[model samples]
Target: MNTRLQTQTAEKGPVSVIAGPWPSYASFRSLPERERWVLYGSAKAYREALEDQGLIMAEGYDDFVRRVTRELEL
Candidate 1:
């Protein structure tokens, strides 16, 4: 848990349970720092480093990114 997951209030509602591992070094490293900062916390992205998995998003994307980056201390 690199960052504390926050409750969301987007159309999809609060945070979802990803129930899997976070991205791997090889997969996560492929993204430019700018892109990595924008993962939607999708189960696919969380487990496999793939973002925008075609489902409704949870938190506001910008908010999610900002919070995650702040917490990651990057």
Candidate 2:
């Protein structure tokens, strides 16, 4: 268990257990950063819409770049 995971778990409660396959790392990474970010942001919205939300998106440094690209549709 990573320290961040521990902290988030403590703050937000337990992690959700997802049953379906997550998007592939390559599919996610190959996307332009901004494009990816937009997609991810939309995905986050979708995730939150669920009655039993389980998605956790803890983005790193590249996250912003990805988000911008996705948002701009570049």
Best by lDDT: 2
Instruction: Give one digit per residue, the lDDT tens place, for model 2 in 34-72.
Output: 766677677655645642455454543266445544544
TM-score of 2: 0.36
lDDT of each: 0.45, 0.50
Off by over 4 Å in 2: 1-18, 52-74
Model 1 ranges with Cα > 4 A deviation = 1-51
Considering every candidate listed, which one attains the maximal TM-score? 2
User: What are the C-alpha RMSDs, in order, of all predicted structures?
Assistant: 8.9, 7.5
Q: How far is candidate 2 from the true structure (C-alpha RMSD, Å)?
A: 7.5
lDDT of 1 by residue, 1-74 (tens): 52334456566575543423333333454566656556434423553342344233335456555655554444
